[model samples]
Target chain A: MKNKSIELMKRYRFFAIMIVVTLAILVVKPDMGVRVYSLAFNSVFEMLGVLPPIFILIGLLDVWVKKETMVKYMGKDSGIIGVLLGFFLGSAAAGPLYGAFPVAGVFLNKGSRLANVFIIVGAWASMKIPLLLFEVAAMGWQFTLIRLVMDIFGVLVIAYSMEKILNDDDERQIYELARKMSQ
Target chain B: MIMTIIFYGLAVIGLVFSFVKSREKTKMALMKALKAFENILPQFLGIVLLIGVILSILSPQQISQLIGENSGWVGVVIATVIGSITLIPGFLAFPLAAALLENGAGYMQIGAFVSSLMMVGIVTMPVEVLYFGKKATLLRNGMGLVFSILVAMVIGGIMS
Candidate 1:
């Protein structure tokens, strides 16, 4: 029991330190404390709201989507189709970039091409379809359209660039890490 | 709100279909989901708190003041730096950027901020590293940072 508790503490050490720091801020500056507390509370709520469905979908995808199917669609030789699918999957996703990481890990585990996975991350980070509405509303169509085009281009460039940069050993290590994490 | 509904709806449909197909696999999926969530929970909590601290210190008003219309390349640099370090949600970030624009912040600066905010995540690097190793994480963020600068220049050129 003690060992388990210690392990838990180690896992949560950063969070613990943050709590201490927040408390210290609260004591030192009550106004900043209140702002931080509310901001943190809102983010916590947002995180909870967005995370459940994503994790559940990821789990379902892991079970239902066969590795062969994933590879066929997104593997090294999947080509243009894989690229389009990666962008589609990512643009369709709803959540923050952090939420995309686990899904990316699952993609790697499922034999997805490295470039495809990077495309997904890039799309998730910037080109989400739903958020595009928000962007257009706030930034105007001209600004939004330009940024959208640039972002799509940037995603492709970054994805392929990373793919080219990483050696065979790096790719294997990434895949291995994903497999271990997903398991 | 609509997105949330769509997500939950899809998840429910998936769960129902999986359960109908095989109860054992459904159970396994739930277990995997739970385990994955647990694994990342610590990092998530830490990131949330870190964001809270960063946002509180650098409020939207301060951000606008720092990146005014004539702030030029220096402002873009500062904007990208702030965006890279902080993890602001899109909902808040968009409105904040719009407000910054209204408050005389340059297009280049806002472009840099938005692009970097989406692409580069210094605060969430721990979680990213857990999934993608240090080398890949660093390289991706480096690319993202460089790309954000490019994005800023393009927006500045055409828009301004």
Candidate 2:
């Protein structure tokens, strides 16, 4: 019961705050507040519409991405090759920053080191390789290429720096999870 | 029915392959949902509100005058810088850039601006910091800003 309440609160805090803020705004200026909320909500819903296809792709990957691949290629000590492996995997992985975070957490759980996970998640947030292909088609090849190159370089710089800076904070559960998975 | 059938077929293939391989079901489901929600929905809304507000506030004419004045190279620089700062959504960035292009804005400027919009974003800095740490986010974003401008210039030179 205690856990349930905490979970509910965690999930609904943004929703609750939004509602309260809207109410406060409405009290201050009724018509304008409704207008703004309506606009914001409409925008949010439109964003939500892009969810399904991405989800389907994720479903496909759940069956595909492997532990050995991650370990051999994207492992912490595996230098440039590992970095390339991380960059490729991350760029290929679909989604925005939020989507990448939970996956990174999972990677940590799966015995993937903090650094590789950082690189991968960073790429996921910043790099959109597949989307760039469409962008080039609609907008021009040069434009897309420039942006893609910039993004790749940026991700590399950030990922490398992060590999230097961040302390390993993962709990002992990494080995535990690795053991369970192998079993 | 065909689409649904295909979906089920794919799902069955995926699920069967996983289950037979002894993969974890709950982890897989949660993972799928999380990735999807993270990518598409966020960009969609994030783009719409950001572009909507900017367009609502600043007219195309205003934008053209401020950053669209020069077709040679100056406009490209200004547009790229502004776009980098503003952080427009990906899907929406193109259509809007297209409009700006049609209305006397240079393609290179549009290109650069659109490029920079995604690459260099101040609004997302907080979240980036949270995930990647403060120093890396700042340095990377700083690098991104420089790279985005250079990208705009090169694309501008190529087109113009």
Best of the candidates, TM-score? 1
Q: What residue runs in model 1 are displaced by over 4 Å at the alpha carbon?
A: A1-7
Assess every candidate by TM-score: 0.97, 0.64
- Cα lDDT tens digits, model 2, A24-78, are 7678878666665566665554434433433544454544667676666656667
lDDT of 1: 0.92
Instruction: Give the DockQ of candidate 1.
Output: 0.80
Tens-place lDDT per residue, model 2, B121-140, is 66455444433456555665
Docking category of candidate 2: incorrect
Tens-digit lDDT string for candidate 1 (B40-90): 899889888888899899988899999999999899999999999987889
Candidate 1 lDDT by residue in tens digits, A1-183 = 999999899889999999999999999999999889888998888887778999999999999999999999999899999999999999998888999899999999999999999999999999999999999999989888888999999999999999999999988899988887787
DockQ of each: 0.80, 0.21
Positional deviation of residue B93's Cα in model 2 after best superposition, in angstroms: 1.6
